[model samples]
Target: MLTDSHTHLYLKNFENDIDIVIQEAKKEGINRFILPNIDETTINKLIDLHKRYKNITYPLIGLHPCSVNKNYPKQIEKLFQKVKNTQFIGIGEIGIDLHWDKTLIEEQKSAFRTQIQWAKKLEIPIVIHCRKAFNEIYTILKEENVKDVGGIFHCFSGTIKEAEKIIDLGFLLGIGGVITFKNSNLSNIIKDIPIEKIVLETDAPYLAPHPMRGHRNEPKYLSIIAKQIASIKSIDIHKIAEITSKNIDNLFFKKNQNII
Candidate 1:
């Protein structure tokens, strides 16, 4: 089976026919969908989806870096309450993003650090969302000495050197639709990196792959991503699926596959 390691099935884009979307994905062998939480607002929706599809969907919780603001302390408190109250696969969609605005850079760092601490305390992996702030993120991660709890760098778009650094720091490169872009350098990086250090994701409702590019993305498109990787690495599609799925299982579902 294929796994879309990072997606937001709780988003409104799937509101109209989420069951159909999920069913279609299952039909295509994209059975496991890892749902990453954005903020407090989507917590219930994420949990509800997990409850409804207990065996197929895994839920991750965190305050997305983009949502980090002056009131982040309060937000973090609320998030902690939820983290303590539920069973989550990981802590995620958290990190630094300077593309949209840099005014909240400090706040984002604070939030990221707090969540990293939480992940370490909880003994769970993290799902990172990094964009235009790799250097800053790497600095904090290094300073915090957060090596025990690893995670995926969701929607990775970095140089091979950066990718290597992240792997050394105990994180996997999350490959998604961007790798299939005509001018993308991801294919080259994929060729260089070991498949074991990689993970598949859709970041669905965004970053749709080619042919499906410029359109909405979903878990079903993950097969296309697996195919792309197979071609890039010159490995069989089943091998890609098996190894990547095993990687996800190791990181997120090792102790309790039933929950995912």
Candidate 2:
């Protein structure tokens, strides 16, 4: 019943041993993987991977903030059409990131606003990717949803106050490998945020947890994350798994379980 709330299961890193990875994770009690699409280019591969493991893998589609280039209008157009024409559980991996290039802040904001609109119209959660731009993302969300749209702040790295803001917005904080890092104070942050307001993710092929911190991440490693949260919250690992899986199912599967 464990769920990896966010993962890129179809990435190139899993090309050679994708089946092995998924099968091992399945054996480890990782029952479900919520796949977040990078862009239009990766949508087909994401879908192909989902088809192979349809019972466990779910798909979320959106334009990543990092991919918000000069021609994002054209890209968003294609993604918007896909979202409207196709059936996905949610719109995800979307938001503002001023870490890479602050010059494109406005462009990223525009894409975020547009996607938020789509999420509202479709009545689904919007998974956000915020980096060094929490204020901007929060402002946009507040301006858009007075009651707030449910979603995940993927790879969430923020203060307790910021975490509270996300919770108030009816969103969940996506806990990932960064929490397992030696110097990360995320454990302390999570100590305050209730487990109900949190979700699990690997962001695979990117952020790997301890012992495998420098290597490619897989859903099997989700066990380690659950264990970490257990230690942080002074609860059992199974409890962590049960709560996070329940929260994720309530967030995504409850919306459109069959479509994904």
Candidate 3:
């Protein structure tokens, strides 16, 4: 009953054998996959996978920060239109990323604020993607005051202070394969964070855990990440699975248990 709360199974990286990838993931106890949208171009592929996988896959709609540009306003408008017309589980894979390029920083912030407002109005959670701009992202979230429909900070790799700030904002930390990297201190950071305030993700086709580093990641390898966490926390892997799955249920399904 493990859940990969954030993944991009729709990307071309998995296009060749996505069905096999999904099958193998299920066999490894990773039963649910939550696909986050990148931008307008990824909407159809995200929806197609959700339609084909139905109960096992969930979809979110939003523009990634890396996708923001001068035309972000128009892009956000069109993407919001799609969200209104469709039944997405959330709004995200959105936020600010200053890692690669900061040329469109203003545009990225504006787009992030716009999407957060829309999600707040719709009462849907958001999945955030942050890079070298944690302070920038946190400032905007605070300005938006997004505590009501708090979502996840996808691929969180920040300090304990930063983690506390996110939790204070009522958002859950999205822990992923980063926890397994020997060079990453995420395992140490997360050991002090409660399991209830965390969710697992692969951010697949990227950030594959140790032993599989530099390789194309698949959702099937989530068990390896989970096992790593278990070892670090000195808890059974089954408890990690149970608690994290329940955490996902609380956020997405409202603890319904019947929805996904």
Q: TM-scores across all candidates?
A: 0.97, 0.96, 0.97
lDDT of each: 0.91, 0.87, 0.90
**Residue 167, candidate 3: C-alpha displacement in angstroms:** 0.8
Ten-residue stretch with the least lDDT total in model 2: 79-88
lDDT of 2 by residue, 170-206 (tens): 8899999999999999999999888998888888988
User: Which model scores highest in lDDT?
Assistant: 1
Worst 10 residues of 1 by lDDT: 251-260
Candidate 1, residue 57: the lDDT equals: 86
Q: Which scores higher on lDDT, 1 or 2?
A: 1
Q: Which residue pairs of candidate 1 clash?
A: none
Reference-based lDDT, residue 52, model 3 = 95
Tens-digit lDDT track of model 1 for 142-180: 997878888999999999999999999988889999989
- Structure candidate 2, residue pairs in collision: none
Local distance difference test, candidate 2: 0.87
Q: Give the clashing residue pairs of candidate 3, or none.
A: none
